[model samples]
Target: MKNASFGVLLALQFLTRIPIPIAVPWTPDTRRWAVRVYPLVGLMIGSVLTLIAFAMQNVPAPITALAVLSVWVALTGGLHLDGVMDIADALGSNQPLARRWEIMKDPQIGSFAMLALVFLLAWKAVLLWALLAYQAPLWWLLIVPGLGRWAGVALLVLTPCAQQKGLAWSWQQSLSAQDVALALLPLAFIALLAPAALLMWLTVIVFVVLVRWAMMRLFNGINGDMVGATIEGGELWLLILVWSWWQFATVSPPGI
Candidate 1:
């Protein structure tokens, strides 16, 4: 297979539970290319979930929200949520940076992580229900995950990795101007689609900047977990903004 074709499979394999039968060599170049196509993985996830939700449009909003959330988690294998939990544990440790790093690496879930997981998941469900209840455009779902992963890509290229080793370090060290440019093509696609999408892209960029600053202040740099957390955070923010717009627009709001 061509490198581009292989890169697509690699991106899918890395981002979701989807199986890609082709095996691609795991070189730094391949990894960079895979990251370049990361947004495509989001597009694929959003398309499936949007279709499912639309098919069940007649179902109660709360139940539809729960079902979509379940599929979203299963599709990504809770990859970003794990990052959220790790970062929460590290941040809540209140220990020195070194100890906090160790705490992040621990396999056991801490109380902080558990509480964060509960709140984050519940909040996401609530936001999803709001979107469903409002009868917002389902096509916007295609933009949500892409924006989230794009935030991850932004961190990968723009931030310094806190640790001397790990996937983030490797990606940062290997990233090139070309990689950054290629990764951003998805934003152009979003911008051409609608004014709301442009707004969504801007929101993701702003949130990524804020989160990147927080990571530097707390962790001294970015990491795999921080990147993952950024993805989840970006997605949540997009949902909220879309929901808010739907609620306040000239159209009548849906009955709760």
Candidate 2:
């Protein structure tokens, strides 16, 4: 592709059924740029879900919430959530590191895997309940998931890969300061779009700290699972912060 950056994003959207395509090779450089542009995927995802939620708002609240969740799940093909499930199952089992790796590697779902999916879906449901109830600031959806994916990009760019080669390594190896710099540029421009631009940075900071701690305790180093988990968890953490901020703004008085 002429522009590797958009090509990378095209690849993500291609995976997500966004109707974009890569006529050229999915080169390492292109993949790296995709990581940078990964936020756009989130932006698209959030936008679609928000619009669906907005359209269904006059519909029953629960129905609207289901529509939002349905579209969100459909957009990404449930890839990140799958990551969240594998990682959660691995973590919940309290198995040794090697065994955990084996479990993560296994395609077959386990009890913990089932638990993880249930918990994640439940959390997303509750979160959507709050967001749909109040109908969260649509702009934040644009910023939060975009920034969370950036956190995943930052993590890959910073650390050495646990495995020698894979899609994750393709990213780890291909990414550079220039790519990271370019990625931030669009986000910087987004600050003018909303104050949540700064809150987005807070999401990055929190993910880095929390993921670093979790990786050290759980995985001991980076892996594809880590990438997926970071994207999913960081998104949730950022959303949780947004909810807390909303609660702060409008909660009723104690005397009431």
Candidate 3:
């Protein structure tokens, strides 16, 4: 129980800018538990966004959407966004695998990275606006973040590390199939909250598979930046799915 408590704090500290006053030791056991609780960290983030959404429920959706987007970026301190940029710069370089790694390591933002950030934030902002304006279920805001992080956990567990060092490699080393299964238990509870959410979970699984395949093809294996990109991309894709459902589907999303 103490280890699990520390693991939650470790995940929150690593994944978000939220201040966790407790000191968490860096150890193999805590790291493995941190992996197990990644989704919970995300749910914590989503809960914050949901609160913001409710607080500004009456405000103009464009303004509210931007507010939500800003909070989202601020909360994570753009950690995953950095990953998106790094991956974009690497892939856009069109170099060999080794050269791509070199490009990703470069601190300078290239044209591709700038474009990727713009498009990603733009899509997120617009989707948040649509969801708010159209009155999609607010619980989805909670679910998507957890789903995104779970996608990261899945990628970490299922893919080989691009390098034998670094945090991603360490997490991959520490995680096991049981940890992965434990991480998924939260999602099962979420499914019980909204049976319709199973569709979104299915979508996340497909996204993870495609991302894993692409990472193998492009980077030759997974890395921290790739996992971060997976989280950001997963969140965006889930947002897109919810918007599409609200816009076109005949059935109403549960709770709406």
Candidate 4:
């Protein structure tokens, strides 16, 4: 159990910029077990963001939205967003597969990457502003972040890694079907906790399917960049779904 705790901690450290004061042992075994804890790490991120939103309750919606969004990006050090950009660069290159991979690997960001980042950040800000405007429940902040990471776990379990090397393949080799099922237990529990959560859960599954299809069609397999893009895209999709649900719930009749 100590080892499991360490694995969870390791996952938290890896997935966020937050400093963990504990001493952790880095080992092959730990790396494998860490994959299962990603959802937990995501929950931690969501919890922090939710707390931030609550603390800023008196602030104007747009300002609070940007502050929350900034912290959200800072939490992960924009790791997943980097992937989103890289994948966008690769896909927009209009090159052969080999060259596209090269483009993805390039250190410099391209036009497509810039455009994607702008749009993604803008979309997130708009939805967050809406959430704040409605005085949405604090739990709303938790659902999407947690579901995004869960979607990632689903991606890892359901899709094959494109490369033989790197973190994605290493986790793929170590992780199992049973571990994936185990990771989902928290998602089910959370869904049962709130009506919005149920819709978020369903939205996550849909985004996962959409991401899987896009990965297969474009990359022919999955990699870390694809996983990252999936995370960002999953979060966006969840935010859109949740925001829309909140709007409908507020505007519609109680019976309807």
Candidate 5:
């Protein structure tokens, strides 16, 4: 369990710009829980981000947004973002399936990739800005990443592999229905602890189902790129949801 936690933390520490310390001996299994501990990792990260933003009552909203984004870019090394760019580039290509794969493999950024990246960053910055500007409650901040990431992982667990071999393939093969159930059990505990977050939890559940169905239509199955897209898209929707709800919050926020 410690190994799993360490692995989760390491991946979180790798994927986000949050600073934490937990030195553990790396092992064969450490790098293999993209399907397992990603939500736990997101929970930790989102909690830290919310805390930092909430604690820094003096900071401007734009600054806070940058701080959060800076941390995210640093932590994950743009792990999923890279996939988003690659897939975007491939989709833009009016070529054969094999050609699309080749385009993804190419290091050069195509026009479509550039445009998609711009849109993604623009949405990311805008969404965070709105969240901050609305002075969104800390609870919304704390919960968004957890649900978004868990939704992504759930998709990974449910969808069949779009390909036979890749990092995603290994992660999928390592996971079973039981492993996924075990991972999600904590979500129930969380919901039981805080019923208000049920909306956030349900939002993630809905997004996961929609994303899975859409991916099935698009790729006919899921793959690394599909997973990455799911994560990115889910997060985008989560931010939108939080921002929309922030308007109706009963408690006025510090920044507002």
Candidate 6:
């Protein structure tokens, strides 16, 4: 139990800007357990966003959406966003595979990175505004983030690291089949909470498979940047899927 507590703390500290003053031991066991709890960290993020959404219920939807979006970015400290930019820059470079990897490593931002970031943020803000305006179920706010992080965990565990040395490689080395199985507990809990969300979860599975295939073809393997991109993309796609379901489905959203 104590080790699990430390694992959760370590996940929160590494994945978010949330202040966790506990000094977690950086051992192989702790790192493996931390990877197992990545979904929990995401659930905590979703909980914060859900609270903000409810608190601002009376406010203008656009304003509230913007506030939630801002909080989301702040909470994650732009870690995943950085990955999105790196991948964009790499893809836009149009260089050989090795050269593109070099481009991703460059600290300098390119035109493609800037454009991709703007579009991604704009889509998220607009999606949030639409969901808020439509009075969509709040459970979406709870589920998507956790699902997104779980996708990241899946990517990290299932694919080989592109880089020979880095945090992603180290994490891949530490993760075990048991850890991956344990990571699925949160998803099972989510399913029990709202079985209707199973469709959205299915969408994520397809998204991950496609992403894994594409990354393997393009980069020859996965890396931290790819994992980060997967999380951002998964969250956005899930939101879009939920909004589409709400808009066109004859039945009301689940748990409504």
Best by lDDT: 3
Off by over 4 Å in 6: 250-256
* Lowest lDDT block of 10, candidate 4: 247-256
Ranking by TM-score: 3, 1, 6, 4, 2, 5
The C-alpha stretches of model 1 lying farther than 4 A from their native spots are none
How much is 190 displaced in model 1, in angstroms?
A: 3.7
Q: What TM-score does structure 4 among the candidates reach?
A: 0.92
Q: What C-alpha lDDT values do all the predictions have?
A: 0.86, 0.71, 0.90, 0.83, 0.71, 0.88
Candidate 3 lDDT over residue span 203-249, tens digit each: 99999999999999888898899999999999999999998888886
Q: Model 5: per-residue lDDT, tens digit, 54-94?
A: 87657787888888877765656677787788888877776
* Model 5, C-alpha of 50: deviation from truth (Å): 1.3
lDDT (Cα) of model 3: 0.90
TM-score of each model, paired residue for residue: 0.95, 0.88, 0.95, 0.92, 0.81, 0.94
Off by over 4 Å in 3: 250-256
RMSD of each: 1.5, 2.9, 2.6, 3.0, 3.6, 2.8
- Of candidates 2 and 1, the better by lDDT: 1
Candidate 5: segments with Cα more than 4 A from true spot = 1-34, 192-194, 248-256
- Output the better candidate (5/6) by TM-score: 6
lDDT of 5 at 172: 75
The clash number for model 6 is 0
Question: lDDT tens digits, residues 146-216, model 6?
Answer: 98998898888988888789889987887866786688788778889899777777899899999999999
Evaluate residue 133 in candidate 5 and report its C-alpha lDDT on the 0 to 100 scale: 74
